[model samples]
Target: MGAALHLAHAGQPAPGERHRTKGKGGSGGETFADFARQVYGDQRATPLARELLLAFGYATMVAHSEAERDVHDVWSTARKAMGATRTGRRWRLDEAIADDAPRYVSSKDREHRVCEAPRLRPHPDGPDDFRNVRGICGSLADWEHYALEKQLGTGWYKYHWFCKRHLDHLARVREQLREPNERAPQPVPNRGGLLPAYFESDWLGTYRHRLDSPTWEPPVYGISADDWPTPGVEPVAPRARLRLAALDGTLLVEADRGARR
Candidate 1:
């Protein structure tokens, strides 16, 4: 747990220091470090929420490791910055992209909206091509038929999207299928030595193995082959390597390089 070990004391600002910044007062002015601290302290946030936020905070820290200011596109930035390391850029292929959420909320079709313009599909041969993968507009699918998967488990997700009426019926059916004595697992906070296990076992473990291998092909949605660091070719940055070390279970190293206060 290199830098995430003692996150509470590492280069943190004083009690009143965070509020002095010029921006939206309170949380809006807060840095990723400040936001992480608040999430850790908030008793109301669920364990799942805490885990998500902390992981995001760690990703943010790694993304802007060379910069002092926070970035707006933390996810995209992190994907690019960590592309060369053993972490690879793909987070989770099964998780539904939040950017695609708004379309599902509207009663009317959003396909014709000025903002929802048609985009080119990835090249058939590969994402990387001499044409830069640019192509003609494939027929846009209708907004009404657009569906997204609901993740159920590892390598598993709902096969089809359901309407509200069908979802209500399915909810009842699912409840009936559960045993009377069955109980859901209680969620635990990913802190006080628990985070390292969860991070290593689930979060980083997902893509770390693929990145460590040599024969990996660049996925259309993930980092390109050019971004992959070749052995003895391009040296991996210290920040890129720090994320993997931070989640090590047996290590007790000092956490010096952390997000700015």
Candidate 2:
């Protein structure tokens, strides 16, 4: 879906240049986009970050102009996975029977038979295979974690939490879909489900009460459904607020700075 489509549903005022919040006070800083990269690890986060800034009545920040070495190392991974194999005087990548898992071993060896494209050639190591690839995504170590978890996490059986997180990651990634990544269109939106939307607002309100009354701040912004306390689950004060200020287009920024410590 294009931003235009999203904007339609968002018939809310396009904040644009009209509601500029003040620059960060008392905290020395970077530009909004740069700060977004610092905290979220991506400079492209600038636009979304700008949205977040305005929600709270804060101005955009100044950020580093140069891309820092990405926190995740990607190069070493590329070399390992891309190396080809030789069989009967012909060389090809291994048949990696791919699926969407960070680890590729599902009993569901269902490769893309749609056009039979994957089966025709040896499987090149996927970009997610950080064990060898590099840059902008997946460090070698992150890929290695996938590989290691494949071996150790119940013989590559994924955790329920893994599936949940995968769904959220998939959504955010889809929101960023202008560029392609290893992620594919999901069969379904299997993340914690729409159930969280109901409690998310209320839970956050109480969480903020805990923060500010002592005075207020969130333990963390944007609580995942999994992290919520259940009925009779006592609420604990959150550590700090998340950057975004509102939901349903009514949220306002009441705090600043990315981290307290």
Candidate 3:
């Protein structure tokens, strides 16, 4: 998606130059294509990072053009399963598996068979193992968690799959909701739920780095559906402000920074 975005805007002039070329006639300075080529095509002048970006951009364009059918099938299926029906209700990813939780799980099982387990580690070592033996869109229904959960007879087993990036995002959201004094939950061997250690370790590394940075910032505690207090559960000050911020695409980073100041 990032590659696609980069490619989408690669042909346009830079923000500063856009005004200059707005009304230019033929042969007016450098054409937009010429400028794009100079900025994105020149191997000798482009930095290694930029060259790699251009390569990705080209690859993205090619993939979209050639794999249109496969992309459509995968995304359409996932979208429909996520409760993207004609209803006026819009799904909030921050809430995750929003609306009817049971229905969402059922749809995942019946319609989309993938791993939506937020707590599972997609890759322990590195990016190479990002996707399991099954390709990117492959189902993880036969994974250990699912099999174990089936044998144990318990709550909804997550049989949906998400890309590594989204799994990382969910991990961060979970960390943000964690109380400062909270202790990490130890997972029982072969248990079918979240393993907190994997996410905690990653968050701790980032937290330590943030503490050592020149511009230190406090952690953002954004709540998710799991953190939401239920009736007769625990009564707590609702974190609706954080959810609203996430919906508006800000995530309250600036607001939190100002509050700290």
Ranking by TM-score: 2, 1, 3
Candidate 3 similarity to native, TM-score: 0.15
Assess each prediction's global lDDT (C-alpha) against the native. 0.32, 0.24, 0.27
**Residue-pair clashes per candidate:** 0, 28, 6
In model 3, the clashing pairs are: 114-159, 114-160, 114-161, 115-160, 115-161, 116-160
Q: Write the per-residue lDDT of candidate 1 for residues 159-249, one digit (tens) a residue.
A: 2222332445335544553542134221111112222222222223333342343343322211211222222344212221222222221
Best by lDDT: 1
Please give the distance, in angstroms, between residue 207's alpha carbon in candidate 3 and its true position after superposition. Answer: 15
Candidate 2 lDDT, tens digit per residue, 18-53?
212225342323233333333343222234332322
lDDT of 3 by residue, 42-139 (tens): 22221432432233223222222121223333223333333433463643211231111111122235444454444344554445653443334333
Task: Give candidate 3's error at residue 129 in angstroms.
Answer: 61
- CA shift at 173, candidate 1, in angstroms? 21
Candidate 1 colliding pairs: none
What is the lDDT for 121 in model 3? 43
Error of 2 at 239 (Å): 6.2
